[model samples]
Target: MTGTAKGMIGFDWAYCRALAVGVQDGIADEDVERWLPEARKVHERILKERESGLLAFWDIIEDEKVEERVLEIAEHFKGRLVDNIVVLGIGGSALGAQALFDALVSPFYNLTTRPRFFVLDNIDPLTFSQFLDMVDLGRTVFVVISKSGTTAETLSQFLIVKERVVSLLGREALKKHFVVVTDPDKGVLRSWVRESGVLSCDIPPGLGGRFSVLSAVGLVPAALLGLDIRELREGARAMAALCETASVIENPAYCNGLYHVIADLDKGKNIHVYWAYSDSLYSFADWLRQLIAESLGKKVGEKLYGPTPVKARGVTDQHSQLQLYREGPNNKIITFIGVKSWPADVDIPPAEEESLADAGYLGGKKMGELFHAEQRATAWALAEAGRPNITLWFPQVTPYTIGQAFFLYELQTVFMGYLYGVNPFDQPGVELSKKMTYGLMGRKGFEEFVRYL
Candidate 1:
């Protein structure tokens, strides 16, 4: 938190020491503060360049049209009897939606105020086939998302869904059962929207898939959940404003980014674990896995960079991975996420009988209390064992707070990209693997890439 802590979320690095991480392992405020000037310089340049309209994600927080379009599209099918929302996307296209769905939606949404939601991000044959067999096409709407509109796995899923819809409900069902979120100007999906009259929304041009969840890619799903999508963006806009502040040390985004880089480069910690105590929050870590790994895991002038991102849930991972974190390779900086309050809680209830006396200590306590108690204990254990860790506290889980968390980490990752001297916007390594897949799948122009094999 350094000097810029926001109420939407509280950053506690107390065990990261008084100002967050202490001089443990030779790291302290002095170590991280020294990078502030460089951070300030980077921010000034990026902010100036951002005005040139180069960073689409940064601008989305203020773009009302994107939200308008998403809500408009959501109502088209949402007004009907739609029962399921199956997102056909992969990587960036899928992770953001998954994060939002898991974080903001109820664990039992299908049993309550909404429809069942699924993200078909992978093309594993068995999983894909089983998913298709599981949902009713008549009551389902397939949301196809691909910024380029030519993503292989997504397009394949779309084709199969479209064919099934066409066979069951005829070609007329296409407009009602399918909606596409893709490039506005040009792409296969764009052209399809025009020619086929399928409902569609534009993902702002130049908005990389990873950073696009704030755009149509995420809002489309948020809209489906009947969430206050505007409030979500408002949270993001607020965080963006904080990240844009003049002083780098006063901004959580910059300070957090600088320290992680400090840990990786100066302390030789190459793994960063995002361990969340809430099950609903596990998806954000999954999303971060892609965001940090894909954005910073780059080769710059022959040196491979970036801390490997690992996702863990407290209590579950407390039993599973905490041992390694405490005694394994002392090469990780774990970031623990905890909720300040549970939206709803259940009492532990006194043990049924004396036979269950071993659990009597928790009789009157709320489950959330126990949940966070374990989280607190885990952080203390790690820090005590000399494993550096940080915590992000959510006052409560809501669309607005969820938005703030997304922007916080996304901006932090981008700032870390600058400190590492790489273009966070591009992923040439992922692109190479994509081309190889296209070649092996028999795409026309990718024939040459297959030769590399």
Candidate 2:
């Protein structure tokens, strides 16, 4: 019983108006309008580069055969070789799959669905030991993802799993139990795949791990979970097509990023807080955090660019963080994500006790009504307190809307980078740490990095 089939997600900026939040807190159209020229240029650059192998994320579905192959592979694996699926990866490798699983799959998917899913994204020893005790080697298959094929956390875990599997079931088990997503031509994983004859997928070269969610990095795990990877592609494709223009007035990503640019440069709002109102969306919010922090938070020579990103859940964070957001420094901009229509709901029965009238006010209402009310109240309260905020609405959490969201935020981060005069793609700051870890682990060539540690 949805009101109407608007079928698209949208935003509400009324709370961000000067009339609502005051002149100092709210932004006029002119504030963002001044930033539009540069936004359009960035938009143009994205559109131009989307097909040129520079922005591979935009052209994720450019080849129809890619989905065809993904579906074929998914069909072969879902009902056949898989009864329990495990993903061995971290950061963008693991987060995209986790987000998609949490959002699109049932909350009790392991108990109800054919394949029980798990993502071992960390290296906690007890956690790994417990996971091994829980899974059946004969029925479980692993999706190992690493573009470079040598991520320390992921590779070490893979080594441990390999030894356990080999000792229990012999080396033959490796071919049947493991599937890899990595570089096509280079890296230790690629070489291992060629030698061991393991089933594998190629992560596109130009796409970084953070932006690789749309490629095989995300698609393989999605296929394993029996999700509609095609619909996900369609959603992203639709958003990408809609955002092909150079006008920030017409493009949602450019328009949204422009608002933030103005907030950062003109209003000194350096903290971007995202309040996701649903549990399913929390992982996506985390994905956005890494995307923003890694892509936009860079220093070239002497100047650092990019705002700090903060994430919170709706009613839960309201108790813990809302007080600070409401009364603390006015240097943060907040975005709330709300679901316009929920897939399920329960009606609250009328109160049995006469004196429990305080609680009885919520009787006979849909449970979602309270959830929606809390979000509405939070927005109202934030606005009244002159804290600038906006809501990004999802008609429902589907593969399409989720895809649209990932693309939107990725594009927005890119726009922020262009406006801030920084390269949003590479993360040079993270490389030194990787080198130091390798040296500390006694890898052959990185010994000099040990001194820094």
Candidate 3:
């Protein structure tokens, strides 16, 4: 089944293509072949670690308890006549949900029938004020997401909003306005939910924040936006089946990882540009940037190499950054994501005879053809310039494709982390800023700053 799917997707020769290209570019092609079997072994292990029941991939979806809880939360909000949903989170908690929402939902997402969903994931005071200004407190609902239940930025924002809601709608409004998603039985937020009588949901244990999107972390917003959460889960399940196979060349994740590893470790390309052809997918790029950076960035030995740089959504950026990419430094890898199909509602007519004569070019090609030509030309130019690049061609930007893409990149990141000898599951570097901020807030030793104040 996995082989059939790979063949259907034209991914059967990816490993061979990667190996051939790696050798031609004078990168360590032998390492790829030698590591191929090991990569497959590790991927299988990961699949087994997550497999349970009918879901071919991770057990998170198959867990009756988890699904029941998610549905309960959805029902709870649905029955309460909530009109607005404000999600308070940052990084993984926010990015995945926002990206999925933007991709799968309408631009005017809440036009008539659905509850409007808003994300407050950053710490911009102006933005928070703007959000508060727009919504009616009497009809709003807040979904607070913090795995630790004590993320300072998330908590700070939550407190400000909570206070405002209390002031406008009174203490009784708390039950109507708030629900918490945090660690199952831990964290300050969980305790607060218990004491304050706000409903609570659990972020699955052993699922790191970056990887929790398919879990309730992402699905809650997805449900609110009227997307088919079950289809997304099914797509993930399909991907999980692919990961179980023991052939590196046949596995999309393995081949992708091999390409990334060769580019970064062997070819000295440290920066990664995830360039997408469509404006709608810009959020997807941002979501992937966080996933790759947070998962792979780590200092090993005396060197300070991490996934330090990521740029996204090209064609527009082609005008701005293409010059630097082509002529500047040989320190980056470009990954192009192209959608192979479009809605029938969008169309562009061929050029007329007069227009063709003026331009001195072909007259009967579709506009999409021209755009794809430019993309192909850019790929050739980058390849000719000794810049390593890869392209992921999706059949279309539906939930199924998005699910496959997300899982593909995520699994690739895991393999890349293993190749780099870093623990992909934990992020220690993110804690540094949090600890420093707490210390600064505590007034424990601010004498140095006191003079300036």
Best by TM-score: 2
- lDDT (CA) per prediction: 0.84, 0.84, 0.72
Q: List the lowest-lDDT window of 10 residues for candidate 2.
A: 1-10
* lDDT (Cα, tens digit) per residue for candidate 1, span 243-329: 777776678887778878988988778899999889889999999999999899999998989889999987798788988998998
Q: Compose the digit string of candidate 2's lDDT tens values, residues 1-453.
A: 111225566778778767788878788877776776777677677767765668867666666766776666676665575688889999989998888998897788889876888999999999998988888888888899998888999998888888888899898878888888998899888998999898888887877889888888888889878788888888887777777777676777877888787777788889999999998899888888889999999898898788999999988999999999999999989999999788899999998797887788888999899999999999999999999998899999999989888888888888888889999998998999999999999999999999985
TM-score of each: 0.95, 0.96, 0.87
Comparison by TM-score, 2 against 3, better one: 2
Clashes counted in candidate 3 amount to 0
Which residue runs of candidate 3 sit more than 4 Å off their true CA positions?
1-31, 37-57, 79-82, 108-114, 303-305, 350-366, 443-453
Tens digit of per-residue lDDT, candidate 3, span 356-431: 6665453556667767887778777776666666677766667776776677777778877877777777788876
Mark the regions of model 1 whose C-alpha exceeds 4 Å error after superposition.
Answer: 1-7, 17-26, 111-114
Error of 3 at 10 (Å): 6.8
- The per-candidate count of clashes, in order, stands at 5, 0, 0
